[model samples]
Target: MPNIFTQNLGETPRQALNWRLGYAILCFGLMGASRGIDEGLISGTVQQKAFISKYRLNDPLLSESERANLLGNITAMVQIGSIGGALLAFLITDKIGRLWATRQLCLIWIAGIIIFITSNGRIGQVYAGRFIAGLGIGQTAVVAPTYLAEISPRAIRGLCICAFSGSVYLGIMLSYFSSWGSALHISSHSQNQWIVPTSLHLMFAGIILLLSIGVHESPRFLASKGKKEEATATMSKIRNLPEDHPYVQTEMLDIFEQVEREKEATMGLGWIGPLKELFMTPSNRYRIMLGLMSQLLAQWSGANSITIYAPTFFAMLGTTGQSEKLFATAIFGVVKLVASLVCALFLVDMLGRKRALTYGIILQFLSMLYVAIYLAIVPEITEHFQPMGNAKRAGTAAIVAIYISGVGWALGWNSIQYLINAEIFPLRVRALGSSMVMCFHFANQYGNSKAVPSMLLETAMKPQGTFFFFAAVTLLGLIWMWFFLPETAGKSLEAMDEMFNLPWYVIGRKGAALTASAGHAENYMRDDVEKVIQHEVSHDEQVTSSEK
Candidate 1:
């Protein structure tokens, strides 16, 4: 419970605890549950593989590729559901507040799980539930960090949000453990291979349901809509800090100023008119382009391809020890969790979001390079392992490498991309903009899930070639990001609009007038972040800080 660093930072005691607990529950729990259910390789594929062997369907369906596509369809279905939830963000997010929205999402996820388990293990029901669960997952993806960014002390907001990212990768690793459990033939359904994992997911989803209700909503949402008393009450409860605290007043007043501007810009038409206006404006168009592209690029990185196919790829290399593979995957999860903490704890506020993203792209470049080598040049070595028993270690090593890519993922893949989306858009269109990106993101994800599985199944034999293709793509994405995407570090929506080429109607009083009167967003956000070693904020001294 004691640390050498934060031990004497001169910060309030409960303040740190407040941030950590909120993060552990809201961000961490969301990541753990959402991705936990998402790793189709965990329960679905293992189960399907088992069925193929059991029913003698393997002879026909084992190599059919359609079977895997079926599984990918299920994966895509969840994203499809997320697109729907994101689309609804404008109407629902602030109204319900971040905490409530996430809880509602958790409940939706639970319903899907219940349907999945109660249907006598029907694949159709499973897919249907996936669609529902995906919707919840998508909402959490948008809402969790949105709230974290809103309510967090500006000094450590990025770390809090990134924690959510760490939790997601951890969840994926957690899901993979289910497959390992199945492979170990432990519990009731290991005889069938995937049944244990399926039950395991339902159990986890149930736990998430219980956890969801305990979380508090974002105080920012409450204040933004003129719910002053409620906002104060929520902040008090969440921070366990009194309304008189300097930090609480700073947050509330900040929200008050932004909301005052936004209320003046309110167009009676609600989401419809403004949704059209956002894209119609030139500057908004540029912002939207970058936001959507960031998300699209994240998906194109083939993150899922590496994640879902790790076990199967390991198998092709002849890795037979189910237990070891699971442990390796778990280790990868721990790495991601630890790395995220490091970033949240020290690096984020120091290096800045733009730098963090650049760092992630660089990591992806290196990891994917290794992946390419294994795929293109390793075929001869794989053949040497021939049998599963003989090749298990090589296969497991391959999977471990795949998890290395997961480590980079914790850095920028999901959280960074989403952070950009969340940061760039003005409050007026935040949910809508995020939803639009999610929709596009899902559309892209659908293509990757479909294409990559088929690609790997056909080409995994060539170690270098397969990885080289992805590596090249990742490098290209890096270049594209550097040239096209502008830095968003610390600038609020209105200022970012100015940085882009946004028309006044989007972030200015003109945009405010288009909807209501007060500007819907602020322009500057200077976090009281410490320097690399430590820096103090002076009451009268001007401080310069960068943002994502």
Candidate 2:
């Protein structure tokens, strides 16, 4: 039902804005879907007995510890691919362009999907497929936010990126439901359950490839490439206005000015310039640290563990059967999807970045602590054991706590990191800097995914201890956020340098960096408008004198 172009010719500007948003969503939608497919694979893989059997995980020939190590490797390999993909995106995004890089990666994802569904229980094929698919995911992670930020109006930038983040949840929910349906209807011993889930990845990749066609390149990128007229034309088309329209002209000048400033700051270092620039100044250094720390906090807060290993987590909570655990995981996905929508729609811009994260971390800490304490008191459910009534009630409560913790993550950490990271750097270094931050995220994600399963199953902390570890990390994250991250809501991309350069306390205060930047931009725009008006008036006077 979605129209690719704006309907109703001669429509109001508001309708035009709607059309622009529709186009953005269409272009960015695949980024989220790819993420969902990437992260969602772990959920079904951990649950698929056929996948386990394919590798002889259940064979009496292997020791339990060996099987654990093998499963860990399988689950963690995707992160390895992600890390590789991040590096590749960094090298290519600036050189070739965001749209081109994204388009090529989507093709790779389709190829990976083909390999994945046809692997037919071959470990080598599956691992290769996972790594290739991860490359696509990594590229999307680094490019989507940067691309979205450049094209969006400042007033709605956060909202649009939040929607992009929400699509990841949508993909995750779709994955869960697909796997749940497959598991219910497909034979447990058949490979179809896992294959059906993977096929969905192919569907998403195809959509992304199709939607990517003819999407305009970032105007900032075009300007950086020294194609000023092209950049202006692209901006005009994207804004649905003439090149000289005050709004379009104002934005074009802002982009051009920022690009010049960034060139001077980096001394025109080109590809390697961003790395040096990142640490050359104290503010830039701090921003890099902020980006890295934010990602680390997002990972260590333990939401990902709950996401990738939900079925296993529910089993720890004493769910009676495989079906029950899968269904519970599906419910968790639903909660996460709803929470993501709330964040994208109501919180990110309205509550401001700092407060939303602080509140979300507090909620996360409480919920994690509740789950840990409740689990510590309740007995773990053994395969043949029947739990008492109160124990069953307590177990159900623990599951609810998991869902609440997921909500906390969605509200604060989920999309905010991407939005913040995307907003912090100038265009010259935006892609490289975002890739650097994404590398940290993917690296931590790899480590976490690899370690959490073993930590849950074999550690001194057991399942309860894992949550306790995450709660402590959440407390640390809260402290980091309060002192470091400033409010970026409603600020122009060109204003970020001013925003970050201000003292920590002054950064978010009312009518400080944010206000000054807006006022400064207005001054330039006002001058341009006045100049045009004067020129028109003078021309009319000359014509009147000539007629006389």
Candidate 3:
């Protein structure tokens, strides 16, 4: 049977999708679980009776504002560390290479988790540990997608890159189950209640570190460093093709040509060349705007806040009791996981990036709108007031709407936020560009996560207002994307320049069409590869005869 993934392979060699490449993508993709596990586990962990009692979070003397601030600080600390981590990642990845960077970050993640679980009664230690871990966890956002995009075949690039996004929900789902199980199986008075679920951080980090040992460095990074022979060998191994194979040769040529072009564009600029190119060039500046805005819009859409505080949101929506709220949150994680898988397997490649985003955003908007209206009509529901008849039914639908919003998030912003930054920039500054974008990604996320507790307060936005705010942001994002986001599916990394070359005003709407019309050469045909091979063979023969 033909592989469903290969439907878009066009004329590309089948060997490009080998087990070695799969293993590598899998290894890097697991990096996403680091962030997911934290988001899922922390909400339930903090709510654990033992944790709250030990930390004095439930002290009767504590005001609502103080409690909100404390919760925000605890949950948002990792994002703060991630901002620094994202900034540090470019330097680390560029200097030590992608594989080593992964290993180092994994170590940082494990160390932070160790400190966190052993915090005992000290809240400061909890903060310090998560902050330290954020340094490593944050870098994964920059590193994993960058590595996946660089190595993947153009046909399956979306599928490969979405592996990272998909694993996020996988981590969330597993962590949710872990948290739920601990809550049920362990006594609430025992420290092990939260400690056992937190151990998952160590397990994921250690597994990724071990797996990194077997994966090779990115060929694009090797080519950029002027190690052409090593790059070719690495590419050959990843593609499961011989060094002399025309497919491998063509790929190497694309990488080399892009490197040479970037060199010419940044000549005499020294070590700061990539920075200068990123900021000074019109096209790059526009690309940066797109990357920044994508993160901004995605983060404020309130989907992530919901993920981080799933139990809180469920409680607010009328799900009572610790066990009941946690069960609802676990199901929320499952919904997100399934949605992410659907996006990875079918939507991203089949529907194209723009359309997938459009559909996802619409789902998000409708869900948010329904929830907002429900909250507006039944503001007393959150105060433990029971509703009768139709109002109760509407309350249940609001819960369903929250779940639908999770689906929308997985389909839309969650997938695009990571995938777009990875593919949008030139190879010369791919790491730098992705790092900078993710710094903002985490920064905005920190703001959203840190503010949501307060935002949900009666003095602030309140429940109806918060959901309304999210709905408004979702609508704005849909409009911004319609005007600015171009179709990137099936396009080669090197060919992105052509797509971005279209005028800024029309680029989002017409760039892909224009580029396709002009026929940007990706050189996927067998005949094209054969010609390149014959030319190289003839040149080699001439050199041999001349030496004689």
Candidate 4:
């Protein structure tokens, strides 16, 4: 049995989300998961499959090579469009609350589907649709994880954030299943056959649109915008507290306190101010680097590369069933989701920040190294590089092995990276930092979207080579973790600020880490930081009320 609350959840007692919110989370999680086809590869693969089949593509005349080129080009087009959408996320988030941002994303998804379908499988038009669909995925990629994290309470925050990642796998698995279902050999008469996946994708867009309306506005968003009252009310509903509950009061106060601090500090950055402040300070600069670097590790770790091209990767293994293999990927996604959920419970707050990061990095590093060796050592096993004979059997064994290794990493970084980032910054700067990190996450994710295809299309651009690159990056990530990242658990956002202010040499020295030394100054912004923190802390109000 799981205890929902641990560590008493702040002095002001954290608000609990009700069953309605629970249903909302489930619906949205499912909605977001459907976009995996949009993001990971369902739509891309289906479009190509339909294109190839309709043309009855075969050798040089029918040209599998031509189809490959077409697929690569169309996929790359979506990726290019995604970069623009991600950059736009920083701006959209402020205007549209996460819920509405996702709605906007669903609309983009719907547009992509309509365009793709209306083109009637025309190659040129499908590219247009992909670009449009990519826009939604890019936007959702930044917004959904963020919104889920913001609405969720601190206690189960990791689970909520990871659910977004789970959704990614969920979306992709469904895509694979959809694609496998559409295995009819290509013919010009059936050029629109790709519509199966695209149409299903349209369904995802519509359902998520409806689901988006159900969740409360993010408490963080409400707090950030100075909607203290509405923010408090939203917090109350989600946390299952009464309208005037002490928990609601504390959260309201914490939001105001953050507001109060921002007022005292010059809003030098302005609209572009947050962006400027983000890069201006060394403490934040390092965090941005660390966050991006960690995400780079996750992306380059071959985890995502494997996903975008699962059928192709499986073909390399001499494995007979692309459908089975895709399902296996789904299993990996589920396992990662479950593992993250478990880790969120015991290790999130307990393992300390540095420990969780290092552990995740270690697992990701090891998994990438293993995958590199397995693929390179047995490239000859299958036609597509899948295992053959007993070698095939062993390679099949290795696929699961490699996947589990990646899962080990998810237990650490997948959700924790977002959780860690949320805690790493002081409230004043958290959103900027988080969004920038989201930018990096999606940037590399797009890189993954492109790179995996390049590898699949050419043996010279081997998957093993990609894994090797990941292995090298893993080494860099470890050094960064050792040198720069600090333990952040059990400490409030105020203390986290102090931790970030120290020189590299002084960062991990327990005595020095906690106590500011002479000449090297540390400012906790003690008054403002505390005041801001307490505004959202309903439990803290109860304590004061009781003391009075």
Clashes of each: 31, 0, 0, 33
For all candidates in order, the CA lDDT equals 0.59, 0.78, 0.90, 0.61
All candidates: TM-score: 0.79, 0.90, 0.96, 0.80
- lDDT winner, 1 or 3: 3
Give the best candidate by TM-score.
3
Two-way TM-score contest, 3 vs 4, winner: 3
Better candidate number, 2 or 4, judged by lDDT? 2
lDDT of 3 at 172: 94
- Alpha-carbon deviation at 190 in model 4, angstroms: 3.7
In model 4, what lDDT does residue 42 have? Answer: 49
Identify the leading candidate in terms of lDDT. Answer: 3
Output the lDDT of residue 466, model 4. 71
Q: Candidate 4 lDDT (Cα, whole model)? A: 0.61
Q: What is the lDDT of candidate 2?
A: 0.78
Q: Report lDDT (Cα) of residue 259, candidate 2.
A: 80
Which parts of model 2 are misplaced by more than 4 Å? Answer: 1-16, 268-270, 504-548
Q: Give me the overall lDDT of model 3.
A: 0.90
Instruction: Name every residue pair that clashes in candidate 2.
Output: none
Candidate 1 at 95: error in angstroms? 3.6
Tens-digit lDDT string for candidate 2 (1-548): 32312221112233236565568656875587777765766687667777777767677877756666777777777788888888889899988988898888888778877887788778788789888888878888888888888887665677778767888888888888788888899888888877888788888888878888858888888998889899999878887888877667667767877887788887857656788887787777767888999999999889888888888888888876777878888888899999988887677776778878877888889989988897788777788775778878877888888999988888888878889988888887788789989989999998988888678765446888999999999999988777677777666788777767766565545423455535233444335466544644675687699899
Stretches > 4 Å off in candidate 3: 382-384, 517-521, 525-548
